[model samples]
Target: MKKKLLPLALAAAVLAGTMAGCGSSSAASSAAHNTAAPAASSSSSAASSTPSAENVTLNFAIWDSNQEKGLRKIADNFEAANPGIKIKINVTGWSDYWTMLEAGATGGSLPDVFWMHSNEIYRYGSNGMLLDLTDRISKSDKFKLSDYPDQLSKIYNISGKQYAVPKDYDTIGLWYNKTLFDKAGLKYPDETWTWDTLYNAAKKLTKNGVYGILTPLHNQEGFYNFIYQNNGKVISDDKKKSGYDDPATIQAMEYYTKFIREKLSPQIFGDKERAEAMENGLCAMGFFGSWNLSGFAENQYMAKNFDVTVLPQGKTRATIFNGLGNAISANTKHPEEAWRFVEYLSTKEAQEEQAKLGVAISAYNGAADLWVSSNKTFHVKSFIDMVKYAVIRPYSNKTTAWEDRAYETLKPCFTGKQTVKQACQNTAKQMNEALAAE
Candidate 1:
């Protein structure tokens, strides 16, 4: 079985891009948003060859099956180049990935190297459960930290130590079914579109059992967009407060809740909601990350009929772009070999292969265009154009736990079960509690 990364994305809906919450009224605030810096112009530490007689097997886990074939290929190449170090690919669904990782962390049996998300990176790094790779990273001529976008590297740092290397990056977009739009006699969304345009288009598209949009109440993909549009933050610097109660946050929440409040969006529950929405054609548009590209492309039910565009712009055009990092367990016996695996994975060759396979967009510069062209379907080009504005997800040790509470309390606002003010205040109170507990 393929090892999997944790399903934190589906379970709590973490927003992407560091820039998402950094929007400011002044140019300075905007400029304060840090981009991922390019990798340092040096190779990582030299790969020390361990004798073949002492070969050991290491478990590498990830969450997505779409990239299994490509990763297997990568593992094969790593073995061929390294001689005897074997990386056993273990894949699991998102739900089980985190459970297993948490258990592993406690039992001291975590995989030697595993996939890490932006939200949890700080938590793991700060706890000393993950290896500090800053010195190794700086020494590696093949692993220039500056190659990645600025500020991206900062996500993995905690208390002066860096623990993970970025795996890939993804941005959010408005994924729509072309057939649904054509049937409704409406045009597809564009970069110039705004919240008014989105709502109006969704209204026109709603008829019979079909709705114009499918927006989950989860903060990452749903409400976070509105939060950024209206100018809000998820948490404060000291990580002692929640931003849910901010007036801008409330206004953004109100803006997004309109679809469900106005009965323009279908009632949905759990995973079934997403599948039913797509399979039965219940909704024309869905907001999600680029990572969903592979699943939508391979789905027989929706593959040939769908396309994506930049999400409707709010006060300013912004979308969240999140990334995963490859982290080595601090307990691993073969730190050097583990570093080799990570180094090989980050290079342009492996990344390009990933893009060409259409598993997901690669984080390497110049490899994204290959992903857009990998498939001959809808206007995939627009998805790449969105990178210029992509922002990273908020990073904190308690980000996962805090975000869950925030979403749980805010969900009522979307369904009209609670007013925006009550939801925001409750969300803030609950989120602060979670942060405090951490």
Candidate 2:
């Protein structure tokens, strides 16, 4: 077994600090659990497995291919204890994952158990596309909602019915290429660094064929951290209005897009390509969520050349905090098998295994230390450290309706075709319209 990176107490302290409020955060694809806890000694769950459920195949779906290996290993452990079940994992890219899941929901063929994200949960959970696990969760001795953060659990709860269980949480971290910094004779980034420091360094690093940083036209892993750092809000407190036009939000976004205006960042917008830019030496720095840990650690180039640190402070320090949840399909024919698999995933033992395998920072309290230890090549502790001042990724009912459109609405600003102020104003208008309709 891999040893934990940090002390148990330290990890618990971080895990204990929950998302704090209702704002936001948390996946799709792949097919693929046993006893939920005490992994080494799986004596089976509270009751005997239903004989009719034997030889069952539970389809598990997730978006990030990076997590598939670690999750599959966990699934194998589950299968060992429960000989009757088999898991199949289906992998899809982030953009396509939601599309596939939505279609599955409409067609009544959703995966037996799948990952649920905060941005899209309201639509799924409210419409009865997801299994209502409230009663099952209450009865299961193997799983307890108290083991996870309350704010995260609230994301999957609609009208007080818990539809899912929190899986893992993430905070944005700054990834820098140490070799590039060395070449430019600049100091590495740290907690003390600020927005001005980043901009100045980005300028100095922009030389030869490599851009200094990657300012992707994305949200959660991109400008959302900046927006929150500058004390900007994405939506109002009541979830009935948009804050895109707020002065602070506009200024933060203006500063973010300024990177492209001054030629300090590449015009890259896609998610996968952001990491590619780093591995290929096209950019010296970028911001990405902790969930990317598995993929980043797997790349030999990133493993050797890069390190991670907390996001630079703006008006005050902040990072985007979010998490994913494991949910069952309401239409699943094998409800017992699906619940059992999700239950296994939620247990302390399985969650720790997930952390040890570098899959994600497990939502199970105190398991983060194992996750930090799973990858030794980079300073990933920054991910946990930022949780202190983390801002929940913004979300509300019908979040996707407006959030997805905000990207297209703001695309022109990244390319210097529109003023940041005008783009943000337009985005706020659109968002308000969507929220009002909701």
Instruction: Pick the TM-score winner.
Output: 2
* lDDT for predicted candidate 2 compared with the true structure: 0.79
lDDT of 1 by residue, 171-290 (tens): 777888888889888888887789999999999989877888887665555667667766776777676888888888788878877788787887664543454565557788887666
Best by lDDT: 2
What's the TM for model 1?
A: 0.86
What RMSD does each model have against the real structure?
A: 8.5, 6.6
User: What lDDT does the true structure give each of the candidates?
Assistant: 0.68, 0.79
Structural similarity to truth (TM-score) of each candidate: 0.86, 0.89
* Predicted candidate 2 versus true structure: per-residue lDDT over 1-438, tens digit per residue: 011222322112111121211111222223332223224244534223554345988888876655777788788777767668778877654556778898998899999998888888899999999999999999987879999988789989999999989999988889899999999999999989999999999999999998999998878777888998898999988999899999999999999999999899989765335545766788999876687666556555666788999999999898888888999999999998888889989988889989999888998989999999988888999999987788778899888899889988999999888999999999999999999899
**Candidate 2 residue runs with Cα over 4 Å from true position:** 1-53
Q: Which ten residues in a row have the lowest lDDT in candidate 2?
A: 15-24
